[model samples]
Target: MRRSRRVRFLSDSDIDSGEDDDDNEDDGDGEEGSSAARRWRRRMRMKCLSCKEEYGGGDAGTCRECYEEAGETKEELKREIDDLKSKVNFLRLLSVGPGPAGTSSVTRPCFYDVVLVASDSIDSADSECVSIPAHRAVLTSRSPVFRAMLENEMEESLSGTIKISDVSYDALRAFVNYLYTAEACLDEHMACDLLVLAEKYQVRYLKTYCEKYLMSRLNWENSLPIYAFAHQHGATSLLDAALSLIMDNMDKLSKQEDYMELVEKDPRVVVELYEAYLSKQVNTAASKDPKGVSRYSFQEKRYTHDMHMNNIIEHETTNGTEDPKTVNFFI
Candidate 1:
């Protein structure tokens, strides 16, 4: 019977002292024993490059080559990010507003060629609208509306003054700053105001920014008015998001005060909501049915239509008028 021998790898110092050759000679298995010793030496522990700790094959995240390549790529990306941040900071201009003691000595761009006045502030105690200074080149680059108005040599371009109506001073200032920097500190009210201004000026980037902010803050309580506002402003993404939230909470739709206000102000939008809800129900039913037949029956559709008609009629009767426009439910 042959006794089993435990395999151990020889260290560098052991090999330097001739212990490896001695073991091979003791085995007396010639080339085969030497090859086995080499294989045992090759089976050494691996260490992680990042943490510099010994780890098994199963615990290895990546090989040394891949780890080094990944490190280089990460450093390149960080450098690119830093470069972009510096470029943005350099391109941003100082926003123009009133200086200390209501003076116009604010540190703004030197070559600013235009002034925007909020029409709503024209009736203040001083009988003057606070002016916001801006550059025609920046405004034109940001919005085609400004481009057309300025490049046409209109009265605004000739006088170097533009009167913007229905906006407050703060909103006008923020709008001008965003045109220069593409950044804004948004709360719910500021988001709404900026969205309105963005839509009017056709600033697609700022409009999308405000829409994303409002979508992130969507809830059942604000859905109705937000949906109505989005619809009015043609904010398709925000409208779809708000409509989805409203669809999910259909049971509580009528209980909100905003719902009644929306119905009164824009009953057509309410009709569209019911239509969308019915369409969603039909789609859901069709998807669930293996035969692809919608389980939302005709009677159910009629019932939903009747519910919408009844609501409109109730509103009309309460207002004591038979306006055909109120009951017109055509999409």
Candidate 2:
């Protein structure tokens, strides 16, 4: 058998050359477009865990593992919040029921066993006053002062009426309510008023609550007065906060009206403030120039010597070797 001769429109080399030239440009452009489109598509897609929105890879946040962990943490926090809410509700329920409206005494709700009367003025002939009803068990459980007064069969316990001196009627009522409910609506004035009462009664929770309120509202205008009050009440947190604020504004110390007033009324307090300011300056200078001996070093030495002398005086007085009032007022 004779094979038929192959028919071709052009030679093999000619076809190959023609096809390669025509396809090269098209393939190059197509591949480039496809690669760019793939990259663009990738850049347009991402999942945000926080806002739960799609974003580009450029805007990506946490990885998959981190995102899952964050979600689990969020759920755990939600559960903890729910548990706390339940506990608060239970505690509220345990307190006594609300009595009849406008009643002078808590008669219907008989859980209250004691009466607290606020004596607005100790020296005045006629002073405004009010009575607050409370439970002995609740008061004793919350305050050591109340516990001591009632448990020791004092005059207040025998009479069934306790007179709380140097307190306003409203503050007394709020104090009693907080004793029962562990809650109080507070503004700056009320916070300060309650803080005084809390300190007098040794109610730690109420004192802390008032201190936090004062700290949150602290500023230059009130820092001096708050500092003095904190020192009087031994509110350490508020004292530190107020002192820090005062330290930061030391440049305007003498310019403040309260500073002059404090100086006039309490010269010892002013001296302590100066001592602290000097110490702060000395420490700052030492930190900036560790090797350089400056004027601050001499001032620091004097301050240290004064402080040591005051300590020795205090020690001698406490040990009955020196009169307590004979110690110098400055440190």
Candidate 3:
């Protein structure tokens, strides 16, 4: 096939390739040199705009723009690889893997085989364990972030008490299955209802997700039930966040009685409020009239009581250094 001429104006003064080839023919290495030049010209080239790294190519292949884009793609893939490695390390930290040859106490269990006992009632010595089919289904989940959030909340002792009664065995099983699997028969009501169970059981991640789902669809009319759960069940952190959100955005939450009711439910939160009230002693630029929107100040007696609470927490730690106070408090 005949090749099209390259784009450019060839002047009479410029020497043609044909003329130059004939003159260079005397040199035996000229043909090899010309072939190498042609190969270099054909290869794709690029330049990174961010780092100014020059890469290769031409119009038929890729120009500077193509090179830069390709570099970005490589960098992006490299970052992704690093992130995956980090996740792998975390999984390893969780001690999930192969079992040892001997069943002795010295022999460490594999990832799935390892049993973590938080409650003594579980009886780890006599426990029958297996990663059930439902558990396996949601093992590597898309909801790890939610799990992390729940773990954080639980670590902070921000959970309500959980109880199941007057409900079918199937519903309880399904709910437990969902907590273990994160994929057991999910629907709007199921998600909302399970939030209660999760909150009661101190399942922070599940409860937080349910709260987020509710918040995303929050309306003045529909939020009462959710608020009631947080308040009645002792979801202190969740209740506090919800109350702040309502006070800031919802007109109905501005009433002193509603907040006082929430305060009554979780008195420790009142301690936090009392602290904030102390901090706001200097900021008197804004004055409140009726809605009680200014800083919430508490009596000096409660402020001093913080010292007593601290002393008790220290004494508990001295008595037993095994578990954190928050976890011990809950259990």
Candidate 4:
């Protein structure tokens, strides 16, 4: 009879589970033959599906079918991502050329139909606003706010100029450029300012972009103010992310200047934070008592867990790629 190889794969739990299926056996052939067969089998290894490293059955992650399916799916998604990126680059190049001079023969820059003026500029008095030239079609397509204002023939559109309030010159320029190119140079302050603009104009993509930028920079130092700002702007994802970070670092909450300011300026937000913290503590306690004998009922624990998971999903829904590298705008 042909000898069957004796081997097992290793899993993360194998070290702790103390379960070993391979048994030392003395075949009728003899102890020496059995021992040599076992040694040969131990030297054999199969390539892992996930990491591509050689492993025995003990380290196997999934069946071969599932592994191949996963690999094919990953390749398909990668191809889709590349196609989308190419489309975005094509649109940007076609729309944002250097006016009539540098435009490709395939596309020409028509005279801009409307201008956006920044109502608030750091470089000028309140009465003086900086004007940014843009195409009406691009503005309307990128922003519902601009679409409404222009389609209704609002006063600003009738005059061929839109006055954007509570925005700096540089930020307005960046905003218009992003409308055309889907790119922005984001610092914390600029991200905050642009998030406001994105929210007001109902630009979902830009809002998500700025939220991701803010989330990346979030820490205990900026948590309170960011939490409050997110709340005020109706940015649910940013609000949840900031609130969760704040809850994890509750020990230092009271010492921060913004924490006190948040309590004074928006006491309701503070109350909400405390409520979240309490719910987290309750959930933690329930989890530790796995036998359903915790102070909180299983139903209550389940409800909190569901809510927490839903909040996490909301925050993760638009975890898109990072903002592209900063590029100069075509003024």
RMSD of each: 9.1, 14.1, 16.4, 18.2
TM-score of each prediction: 0.69, 0.60, 0.33, 0.55
Off by over 4 Å in 1: 1-103, 107-109, 125-129, 289-296, 320-322, 329-331
lDDT of each: 0.77, 0.71, 0.46, 0.70
Worst 10 residues of 2 by lDDT: 1-10
- What is the alpha-carbon RMSD of candidate 4 to the true structure? 18.2
Q: Which stretches of candidate 4 lie over 4 Å from their true place?
A: 1-110, 121-129, 290-331
What is residue 227's positional error in candidate 4, in angstroms?
1.1
lDDT by residue (tens digit), candidate 2, 1-331? 0211121233446445534654554665777655654553444456677667664344348445656778889989999899779656535433433344533433244565677777764345433124566678888999999999999979988877788877887788788777766788999889988999999889998999999999999999999988888988999999999999998997787678797667545545656676787778778787888987497576766666566456545555555655435454442
Worst 10 residues of 1 by lDDT: 1-10
Kindly provide the TM-score of model 3 when superposed on the true structure, using C-alpha atoms. 0.33
lDDT of 3 by residue, 48-134 (tens): 455555543223334557656788899889998997786554334333233444222312332332222223223345322221112
Candidate of highest lDDT: 1
Rank by lDDT, descending?
Answer: 1, 2, 4, 3
Better of 3 and 4 by lDDT: 4
What overall lDDT, based on C-alpha atoms, would model 3 receive against the true structure? 0.46
Best by TM-score: 1
Tell me the TM-score of model 1: 0.69
Error of 1 at 34 (Å): 39
Better of 2 and 4 by lDDT: 2
